[model samples]
Target: MKKIEAYIRHEAFEPIRLELLELGFPSLTISEVKGSGRQKGITERYRGAELTNWLRPKVKLECVVASGDVQTVVDAILKHARTGSIGDGKVFVLPVEEAYRIRTGESGEETLQAHPGVAQAAS
Candidate 1:
């Protein structure tokens, strides 16, 4: 198993999410975040004052998937998140030692599967 963490432009979330769903990855976590990268931040005028916000808003998308499906998930994120610009964000894949489904006490890859009878694409 692997955990995929993607930091993406805020505007890119919906499209990436829809694509993931279409690819049969319906379970994931999302969070609004702020950070600085090569793009730095932005300057804005508020009340006629120049404000330099050093942390730009971003969306963090996380999901755990079967090791074999890592590339597929990463590709989907890349396809939808790229804008040919800086601050396009980054994706990281890391090893997952274990996972457990609290409701059923299920562990390992089976815990990553869709609930009971829901159809899921083969990994």
Candidate 2:
């Protein structure tokens, strides 16, 4: 199994989620996070005073997916989240050693499938 982590602009979350659902991958975990990338931070002007916003508000998406579904899922996120601008965010895919559903006692891929992000993986 694979784990997909994507850091995206907060404003893009809804579109991204709905796109994923439309693609037949309906489950995901979303968390509000603060982070900065190569841009390091951003400059802001408040009441004529300039300040640095070191950590930008972002939405983190975590999806546990079958290995075969990794690329498709990543593509969905990238496509839906892109704004052709800075802070578009990043996506990471990792090998998940194991997964277990606490309530149902399901294990491995079954556990991942149960996650909201994979309601109906593309065959």
Report per-prediction Cα RMSD to one decimal: 3.1, 3.8
> Considering summed lDDT, which 10 consecutive residues are worst modelled in model 1?
114-123
For each predicted model, how many residue pairs clash, with residues at least 3 apart or on different chains? 0, 4
lDDT for 111 in candidate 2 is 71
Which residue pairs show backbone clashes in model 1? Answer: none
Q: Model 2: per-residue lDDT, tens digit, 23-120?
A: 66676898999987775877989999999988988899998889999999988888878988888999999999998888989898887554454545
* Candidate 1 local distance difference test against the native: 0.90
Query: Which candidate leads the pack in lDDT?
Result: 1
Task: Please list the residue runs of candidate 1 whose C-alpha ends up more than 4 Å from where it truly belongs after superposition.
Answer: 116-123
Residue pairs that clash (backbone atoms under 3 angstroms), model 2: 26-116, 27-116, 27-117, 28-117
Candidate 1 differs from the real structure by a C-alpha RMSD in angstroms, to one decimal, of 3.1
